[model samples]
Target: MRFLLAIICCKLLRLALRLLGRGGTALPGQVALRICPDMLSRLSRGVRVAVVTGTNGKTTTCRMLEKMLRDAGEDCFANRSGSNLERGITADFVSNADIFGRPRRRLAVIECDEAAFRRVCGELAPAVCVVTNVFRDQLDRYGEVTHTLGAIREGLDRAAHATVCLNADCSLTASLAADAPDRVRFFGVDAPLGGAAAVSDAPRCIFCGAQYEYDYHTFAHLGGFRCPKCGYSRTEPDVAVVSVGALTSEGSAAEVRIDGELFDVAVGLPGGYNLYNAAAALSAATALGVERRSAVRSLAHMESGFGRMERFEIGGTRITMVLVKNPAGCDRAIDYLRSLSGECTAVFCLNDNAADGTDVSWIWDAGFERLFDAGGAELRLIVSGERADDMRLRLKYAGADEGDIRVLRSQDELLEAVTSAGGEVCILPTYTAMLPLRAALAARCGRKEFWK
Candidate 1:
């Protein structure tokens, strides 16, 4: 009775919140979990669930998985816009079920935080789990990348029967396979990405503490990585991006080999990191019993989720918003900026909110210097947010000319600058900062409100 009451109340609250133009991802779940502590597990029973947890790409990967499942004609739902915590996930489960607490959908794709995975998995015991990749993120929250890995390891240990999809190129993520080798599936790029590698988040082996050797580098630390001392190496991927045929600011095309089958894959999203997400999603789909061809076909139609490289047009300017929370993710966003073919306006938003690591020191670790150098003198830079001045200072040190740097402290000013920029505008904002900008843009541009 408590479970049913929790579900019904949370559903009504979610509806109420949506009607008020508010995002209903977390609070409803929080209230529901308080009403029934075991609500998540009760609601999750008998569902084929795929839980994706990692430092990055969880949302996009889950987006792909959900789409593939929907295309495969399965009744499915996901934690689309909510918090990715125990409570938020529970709330999502509640919302998908009937008032009697019976599931309307038999499949789910859940995006979970690394810190919350262990606690949540014990209840859900998902049929498939995908660890996108581990990076040094929110040091205040997760302590270290290894600690994040340990958390996921614990989750996998609890769900021993779940098919685990690991990233072969990421040493930190690939190491998890050792815990569940028989049930693990690997995904990664087959050949070198041919760029100077960014500073590796995992420079030493997780097991031996010895420096790693790479056959080639794709972007950050991801590549053909191998440990010499203990002989831990990247296993050949079951879902491999054999070659990226073309990568542009628009999208990317690649030849993806899934298991023993090869298919030409084209992702509608930009950036090389997105390629990894596509590969990871395909691997997870196959693990969840979706056909490989269907998964590959779905990849061609996948759109960017909320703030992970989402694009919009407003007031005559084209704006692409990419969310950056850590040094590695920031550097990748900067790399995407550096890849633009012509001059464009760049907006950098930094916030020290709790969701975005309180310690903003991670920005110093990104390749901002390289980004500024590549942008040349013509690039216009705008810094906005709670820490706009700090971002501006960081840019000045990154080789941005003083004359080209502008600071917009207000949302109206920032939006005006973006709309009046007269060309392609790229906005890179930290977690909290992205929220208001996304809301404002959506309101003016006729896009669906985040809650809806």
Candidate 2:
């Protein structure tokens, strides 16, 4: 009865979402239960489930994984819109399915939120689990990075059988790798050019209390390193990304080596980090017996979803929207922008809500110094959010000048900040803050899906 009511509610809520011109993510999970009362029981029949959960990169990583599975000739059912919570996931299964509500797929790939991972994993036993990385996100909602990490450990414990795909780049994630030793497969990059910097990542050895040292620093709190005190370092990947293709408008290409064999491939996303992400996804698919070239071609054409490193055009300006929910994600966005040739206009939107976590202190951890420190063709630093002043202050300390930075409280003011910049708007926003920012950009730039 509960599940049935949940389904009915989903219908009503979905209409509301459509009317309001927003995504149906806020719909209660009970609606999912109402529609697919026996979702767990039904999944138990023969379907293999894989859950990807982390503070960052879960959506793109999961979407990439979905393409890998589909290329392997598997019927795929997934949360296609980045709805990774209980209610959102329930809606996914309930809304897109046949009346019987039975999934007709060989694989069910669900992107689980850091908070909802354990609940979803308990309800659907996944055979494979992937942890992209753990970064400080939503200091108010999550309190600390440790909380999200703990949730993942608990979720993994409930799974009947699982293979964990982990990023060797992140120290926080590498620490959690110990829980499942033999089952864990690690993937990462060699140090970038110049051999590495003096800055290190190992705050405390995840294995022993001894401080660890890094061979190189990839970005904020990510890299290949091992414990000097303990000896827990990044194990070599069974599958590794040898080279990344250009992150051009046409897409990307790469070379991946599996088991001492090389496979030249093309990937359709930007950034070197995405190379690592694609490698992780494909590596997981290989474990399921998928061929290399087919999966490579499929992923190369995989469409970029809205707001997750997605690109669009507004007037003459090329609008690139990046969802920066944490420090690591923000760092990567900065890195990508720095590499580009055109003048960069940044819209920094922050919000203090249950969804976005009121504590904006994590901005301090973000390497904003790298941005203001440069001060090149980048113009008009626009900062807007419920906590706009805080964001501005942080940037100020990072050496951003007061004259060049704009602080805005209202939505329209926020939009004006970017319009005033007179170049490509590189919009970077937090979790809940993105919806309104997207809407504003769409309205100003005349984008329908974004505005409505």
Candidate 3:
């Protein structure tokens, strides 16, 4: 009876919030948990859940996997609003359940926060868990990358029966396989990405204190890495991107080897980092029993979710908004900007709000200097949000001309600059800053509200 009451209350709260024109992704779950502490565990009892957690790419990978399940004619739901906390995850499960506390869908793709994974994973008891690569993110909240790794490892300890999908390129992520050797499945890119390595979040070996040697590097510390002292090396992935064909502004084309069968995969997203995400999604999908071909084909039709490579157009200008939180994600956004052929304007919106991480010092580690060096005179810069001046100063340090950098704090000012720019514009904003800006752009472009 308590479980049923919790479901009813959650549904009612969600309805009220929707009527009030709000997303209501987290609070409903928080209130429901207060009513029934074990609400997620009860609601997720019969569901076959697939949990995706890591520093980045969780949302994108979930979307891709959800699409794959749907294309295979399986009814599945995901936490699409980007509320990854325990409360938010519970809220999504409640929303997907009937008034009697029965799940309407048996398949779930949940994106969980790394810190919250310890509390939520055991409750959900997912069938497949995908740990997208780990990096230095939310230093104030998660402390260090190793701490984040420990949190995930603890979560995996609770869900022992779940098949773990590990990133073979990320030594920190691949280390989790030690706990679940028999159930581990690996995914990564095999070819070198051909760029000088950026600042590595995991430079030293996770198993040993020794420095790692790489035969080829994809980016950051992710690649063919081996510890000379401990003999810990990247294991051959079950799913791998053997070669990258093209990385255009539209998307990427690559040849992926999935369980010994090669398939030409086209991911409808920009940047090389997405290849890792694609491989992760395919790995998770196959683990969930979806056919390999159906899973591979779904990547080409993936729609960008929320602020992750979400696109909008106003009059003559086209704007792509990407949510940047950590150094690795920021560098990938810059790489996408550098790939543009003609004149382009890049906007960086940073906020030090709790959700965006109180410590904004991670920007110093990002490869912002590459933008000025590679883009040269073809790029225009705009900085906005609560920490616009800090971004402006950071750009100055990155070799951006002081005169070319525009600081537009107001939403009207930022929107006007985007509409008047008359070319392709890429706006990279942190978590909190992305909300209002994305809503404004969605309204102007006639796109549906993010909640819808």
Candidate 4:
């Protein structure tokens, strides 16, 4: 009854949203109450669910999984708009249901929030659950990265029988391999260039409480290593990123050897970090029997969502918008930026909203060091949004020259600053700040390749 009511409410909300000239998310809470007053039990049908959860790359990873599934001729229902919570997931399932309240797809791919995994997973038992990584994020909301990792751990514990995809490169994720060895499949990137790059590493082990050694360090502490004391290390990736050859500011062209044949591909998204994401998705899809070549080709045509490594041409200059919500991601973005040369301007915006952590202190850990390491005087930083001052201070703390940093109180002004700054601007902002920045750039630049 609860599931049925929710389905009815979702239809009513869809109608109300259309009539009110708003998105489906604009519906009031009472509408859901009116429709779904009972428990949502429809999760137990023949419907298969696959959940992707992590700190930084959940959206991208989930997006890839969704596409691969669809390409494999599976009718899939996915949370493309990033409604990872109960409400968002419910809205998606409810709105996409048939007349009898059955889903229109053979499977579902949902991006579950790091902090809300247990709660959301409780509603839907996924046949496959992928944990991207547990990185330091939103300390105010989650306290520590462990809190988010704990949520995934809790879900994995309960759904012990589910096929678990863990990141062998991520220390925290690799640790889970020991706990649920029978159900977990570890996928990692063999960072052939790991020793040469300046990257961050995850510190201690969750089990034995000792520092894990790095055989190689991927970006921001994710890499090959093991704990000597407790023997916690990357336990042989089922799918390892064997080669991440050349990727420039323009895009990346590389090959991942799957089943002896190196599937040659070029991805529009910048960063080998993305290749890592693609590799993980490939592993999950292969586990589900998606054709390797079709999945490989499908990746080249992916559309950028929000500010997640999306590039566009503006005023005859090509600019890429990379969202940096935490230290690991910010570091990866900058590292990828260094992979190119040419004048690049950037807008760094922050928001301490509920979605963004109220504690803006996490910015300190974001390796603002990279912006400076790339050469301080060369890169000018435009700080914007509610936490503009915070961004400014963080840059200064990283020993950035005051002349190189400018703080703009308004998001609109940030765009104006970038336009007039004279270079290809790389807009780096948090989740809330990304849309407004995108809107402002789209208005003048008139780029629609990523608008939808």
Could you list the CA RMSD of all candidates, in the order they appear?
Answer: 1.4, 3.3, 1.1, 2.9
lDDT of 2 by residue, 1-452 (tens): 55445555665677678787666654645555656656644533466878888776788878888888877778888877666777777766655444454555667778888898888888777888888878767666776677888888888888758888888777778666678887887766554521113222336766576776777666555666788876888777766766655665445566777766888867788766677678678767776667766777677777666688776665567777888876667777776666566577887888877767666777887777777545444656888888889888988898888878877778777665555555677878887788766666666666666213
Model 4 ranges with Cα > 4 A deviation: 24-40, 192-201, 259-262, 374-377, 420-422, 442-452
Per-residue C-alpha lDDT of model 1 across residues 1-452, encoded as one tens digit per residue: 89878888899888888888787668889889889998888888888889999988999999998999899887899998848999889888887888988899999999999999998889998999999999899789889888888999999999877999999999999999888889999999987754448646899998999999988888689899899999999899999999888888778899999988899988888887789999999999988888888888888887887998999987678899999998878878877887886778999999999999898988888878877564343568899999988898888888888778899999999988888887789999998999989888877789996557
Candidate 1 to truth, TM = 0.97
Which sequence of candidate numbers ranks them by TM-score, best first?
3, 1, 4, 2
Better of 1 and 2 by TM-score: 1
Steric clash count of candidate 2: 10
Q: In model 3, how many backbone clashes occur? A: 0
Best by TM-score: 3
For lDDT, candidate 2 versus 3, the one ahead is 3
Model 3 residue 183 CA deviation (Å) reads: 0.2
Once superposed on the true structure, which residue ranges of model 1 sit more than 4 Å away at CA?
Answer: 194-196, 374-377
Structure candidate 4, residue pairs in collision: 2-38, 5-35, 200-220, 200-221, 201-221, 226-233
Instruction: Give me the displacement of residue 34 in model 3, in angstroms.
Output: 0.6
Clashes of each: 0, 10, 0, 6
**Whole-model lDDT per candidate:** 0.87, 0.71, 0.90, 0.72
State TM-scores per candidate.
Answer: 0.97, 0.88, 0.98, 0.90
